[model samples]
Target: MSDITNAYIPPAALTGSMRDFRVPGGIDLLGRTEGFFKWQNLRRQNGLWPFSRATEDGPSTVCSAQDDSGNKMRGVNFASQDYLSLSAHSGIKATAKEVIERCGVHSAGSPALVGNTSYSVKLERKIAEFLRMEEVVLYPTGWAAGFGVIKGLVRSADHVVMDMLSHSCLQEGASAATNNIYQFRHLDNDYCRNILTKIRAKDKENGILVVTEGLFSMDSDTPDLVGLQQLCHEFNATLVVDVAHDLGCLGEDGRGHIGMQNMLGKIDIVMGSFSKTFASNGGFVACKSRAVKEYLRFYSAPATFSNALSPVQAATVLKAFEIVESYEGRAQRDALMANIVSLRHHLRGAGLDYYGDPSAIVCVKMGSEGLARLVSRRLPELGLVANLVEFPAVPKGAARIRMQVMANHSEQNIVKAVEILKTARQQAEVEFEDHKRPAQFEARAVA
Candidate 1:
């Protein structure tokens, strides 16, 4: 028999990331993917896989959930991205039902043809007004909007200067659009200025697009928009801000950092999604020029080839915006901020550290991936629901639990989640200390 046993998976594999499996090694196109499968299988068997989980019931502060293997769970939910808790709002539901009855469920065609519902057109106008811009183009998802905007406007010869920690959609979109891409240090305006100055000094003929986020979800922080905008203006570059995480649930009038920074209509391009705050599945790109909007509608493959937002989704988002701009919306933001404060306060009191400024996304640092995976495995069993973000999302050793707080989360939910998380981590720490690291690649079955 071979020296390698049935349980012999490489030690490198244990420490490996999805990044390693991205490029296939062999010539067989289909079979090249098997290594990743086997590695993933190992993670599953070890109870280390924590992705693709499902919810058994409708969303709320607490939830009934299921893990990747279908193990049912119920707990204090902090995994969802419903920052305003508007998904369960009565008005939103009633509006969705009414639109489904009146206009049916399908958007049927792309917006370039027969897809633009009256509701969508009005939604576009309303969003433009809300952002104090002139025109808006809608997309099926926020990701698509981010991708479409860059792909539509930028060319292969043009340049894209982006924040190092920007969302993957923005990064992928920039990659898709051009090879002349530059990355500035995260939230470092001076570094951004240096890159912009270099680009302008060398290539004054082509376009340059600067991409950033209103609020970075992973770090729960924001950029100095005014400074970046000034750099963009000085360099003759365009700026696009992705407001996916903070648009409707943050700031005084719920305009997110854009309004908070007093750059409402001054931005070159604005992109956001309804999923985070509007309680629907849609996205939009707003800008000052009718030309940019028209150009994106036709040239953007995501918008041109995909079905438009359904009338119900469009109407639901419309109603969400109405509520988002209302007095009730202010109360919701206040409540969300209150919950964020409570969670952070209690986490500190309990001797845990969290990352970033006060916003809905609270990233509690958990030092190593080994301990984090153990804690993740123990959490649902401990009656808490949260997400463990490890290597490839954040740095390899800087694992964290990304808690998505909501306006409706009760004080009890916050306290209980913190306690359960603390308990789970303590238990994992004990197990980690006792278990001594596994042999590098032992010739033994996991059983």
Candidate 2:
């Protein structure tokens, strides 16, 4: 069993502290926010936070980021989730510009009102057709789509069984929608089957929703979709698969893990984000029936209350969809897979341990948060911009440097990145050893 199974905390236990007014001495909302910022400030000061810094250059294979010292430094970028490098594609940018000029910038209204334009409608249709679903609904962002799907479909009496390592959006949705939520071990279909069986035995009337992701971003792994679908069928449960990281970037036709598992239309619902591979900042849910789609559209708060995808966002995604289905998309996927293979081979040859299968995302195991942070901080200086993921995202001791491969990255770029990473790792180890010696001596002196 993974550490998530032992350390995972339900979302309900962590949300809505405002209602607990009777607590004698507890952190309020503002206090909680302040605490987070304080910690973030410390991380930023140490060059460990490494988030939301301005990028002076395009989000390509190699890009420039403004450092804390206000220096623009170019590096091999493996932090972006643009698996196909479509975000910087000339055709996508041109379509976005054309659509903005034609329809203006903002929708200025919720999708349920006047925000649903022809571009969004046509994009929805295109998505449905591409994913082999009967209908589709769009959201302003991917997080909203995942959260909306559960809250729209499930009620208080319903039950939700999900993977322990599922996305925060999915967990939050389940927590908000229902109280009877159970999380199985990560990627453990047998555990999921047991949970479903127990739940079905107790409640035969209320609905049961089984949720998992097409690809777990932090761990860089996937679940057995076919097996999970079978279990859901046996228990008369609905299966919702979030393909945010894999859709339009994986499988033979870029249909994601579902296609790879030969369970595309067999699953109850398919949902994903457009930011990763579709070259826009939005999300969608594809289902087999118009009635279900309409119900979600009417009930999902993000769809009903939030402004819809702007014309440019919708058009860019539509053009990206067209490109993804063309020969160019196939070539891109080939290049992406080749890059992943090459990087993994190099890492292994250098005696480094990595997690996950042959996917665009690869995680080098760093064992501890301190080591991971040190390595990540050193990486930018070594000409690599990578992400360091630690506690609350993964298990306590399983910190790693998450690297994302792109189709635009050449062999030379990958080789250079790996070499720099090796050097960074060595430097981090030395720094950590030097930092630890003082603490060890202090403890010894105290004893």
Candidate 3:
């Protein structure tokens, strides 16, 4: 097993992080950003920073892209979020085109006003029915839906108990909604129970929202949903599961962990995004209460203030749901699962360590940010396209390569990806050790 706790001694220029530049010292808020820009630019120039890379084509098993430096790259893509390969499905694309011709582009207003197209309404109902819940509200993006649910339901006096590894949307929503925010260890149900007990013991009058994810993207893990939900019931709390990464791709019926764990229609709140497996740009929150749905529509700033999901997006998601509910959906899920298993098996055979259970996400542990950065720099050149997860996303030194498996990824893609990844890592490891020698020599000289 690899020690994920290993830290790195980066060069003096790359020592600090974006986190270091967050707090402003001077009165000028805009000027405070210069420090972060300086740090980020250094990373961009060296190909160490991998954010904001642009893809030349649509979603596929292979990718052609350009990094921050605008250098061309063509490789096997393992960074896309399209779990079931639904983005390019003929039905999905056709629906988008048909809706665009009929309804034009924009929704014209927030959903709070006249933005509820027939497609949006149907999408909400379909999600509610699929989840076995009573009502649902739509949001412009997955992040908005996550933030809105907590921000709309919980208030200043309420308490939010969450898993420490919950999505940033949930955490930010909790932060924005109240001051009494509490987090337990990742997937630690007993720790969650303890937090709930402590919160209830001190204050039983306020509302409590317990937040968790169906599938954590970074770690590729899920919590014990049943246990967490039972704990919520015992403590008079509401459990909101973010199914952004797993929904529409996992489980027998594609209800994600909530279904696999026999939790359908039982969760207090269900929030998810269409961007992952649904092949669209929208999100939804489903619950058993109509009142709660209405409350979120008006009170959730994202829904009330932001423009509603475009008609084309809503229609595209509707078509995706149509496919996800049919026999074809089951086949797609099976295909996706097969790819996930194959990729994981190959990764293990390559003598690489990955964290968490088998899912669409596969986080291959890299141990140190320095080695990971070098490996990332070598990947594109080695004919692979995978995202490097490092500081701010994970612990500072606990970097990893996050591979998102798609149903369309063939055996060749999986086999070749692992080969290229291993090659890149080997090349980077040699370069990294040599790069460390100078710093080590300097320290020994000082000694």
Candidate 4:
């Protein structure tokens, strides 16, 4: 087989009798599926695929996780996005149980049908009040909110300009919404402005949508919301900001990136997910006009077709909103910031390359995919759990271990996780070196 073919085919596929099958051609849908399986197999061989490690306990500082081999290991969890550590809060749990008892487990139907309960309405009101928006609409999941909003508002005649590194849901929504989709460089307001100006020159009639995230989870970075808003106004475009990663975690009263940037109530639309800090699985979109909210309610697929947010989830998020607006929430945010600072300091002192600003997430650069996968596999064994981000998720050669810090993580837990990570890095480097030497020797022998 040619080296290119060998590079594409996984080691497992090349073993045994499977190597006899011819490689697929073209980048069609079937070919893409075949490529995905091939890549998945390669990741599996390197212990990088099947990343859904089951957690025994809820989102906490530490939890019991099952590895790929089904072996349970208790460790400091740096993989969860529970920024305020509210997912395991006793009050949230109790509220969920009470709501379930009163309203049953399911919503029973779509909100347009029989699903809009008093709990849902109350939660919507509370969220709108917290964000200072005129109205709020809830969705079954964050992905649905992103997808449904874009698909609902923008048609094929409309145009969408998004950040290059926006979440997949936003990108998918844009793709589904319009044919005219443009992407600016990550966080590059000038590039976005240029794109908008160029598009406006040609299509002055169609609606234009500019989409971005309040905080990018992978890079743990935020955009210049004020600048983006200015550009949108100048170019006559609507701006939508997704605060899934920042809301309920940053800014005073958890108003998130918009508040931090002092652009709250300035953007056209604001959306966020509850799973991060609200200790529940759902999402919402807030807007200034009741007309927009009503339009989305009738046009959005999730609102019109999908089942509504369950009563239990609505109640949990409502209680979470109450807590987030309280003094206790400020204290939790302070603790989370402290943990971030502590972990970043340790990482810097160790002479490691990390990315992004101070937030709940800290990404330790690994430089290569092999090193990242190896280190990630070793972390579970070292009593630490972190997420390995590599190619496709991030640009090639920018692999890293993304660590999420929680408000509940003790100083000891932070320090110990850093120590364990250092050890894992060393072990992975040694193993990588050992593997590279053998592979090099075999290649030279074949040559």
- Lowest summed lDDT window (length 10), candidate 4: 1-10
For residues 1-447, what per-residue lDDT tens digits would candidate 3 score against the true structure? 112112232464345666687686999988888888877887776667777888998768898999877888899999999999999998888888889999999999999999889999998889999999999999999999999999999999999999898888998999999999999999999999888888888998999999999999898888999999899889999999999998999987898999989999999999999999999888999999989988888999999999999999999999999999999999999999999999999999999889999899999999788888878877887789999888777988888999999999999999999998898888778767866788774664465
**TM per prediction:** 0.95, 0.91, 0.95, 0.91
List per-candidate RMSD values in Å.
3.9, 6.6, 4.1, 5.2
Cα displacement (angstroms), candidate 1, residue 7, comes to 15
- Residue-level lDDT of model 1, residues 357-403, one tens digit each, is 99999999987876787778778877888998987888788899989
lDDT of 4 by residue, 251-366 (tens): 86788888888876778999888988888899999999989998999998888899999888889888888888889999999999999999999988777778998888799999
- Residue-by-residue lDDT tens digits, candidate 2, 1-447: 222112222222222222233233455655655645555555565566666656776678889888665745679888888899999898988888888889999988888889988999999999998888899999999999999999999999999999999898899999999999999999999999888888888899999999999999887799989988888888999999999999988987998888888886788998899988988899999999989998998999999999999988889999999999999998999989999999999888777889989898899999877777777777776789888777767887788888999999899988998898898888778756655565654554455
**What overall lDDT, based on C-alpha atoms, would model 4 receive against the true structure?**
0.83
Model 2 error, position 390 (Å): 0.5
True-vs-predicted CA distance for residue 350, candidate 3, Å: 0.7
- The superposed Cα distance between candidate 1 and the true structure at residue 301, in angstroms, equals 1.1
Model 2: ten consecutive residues of lowest lDDT: 1-10
Question: lDDT of all predictions, in order shown?
Answer: 0.88, 0.84, 0.88, 0.83
- The runs of at least 3 residues in candidate 2 whose Cα sits more than 4 Å from the true structure, single-residue gaps closed, are 1-28, 67-71, 439-447
> Between candidates 1 and 4, which one is better according to TM-score?
1
Worst 10 residues of 1 by lDDT: 1-10
Model 3 gets an lDDT of 0.88
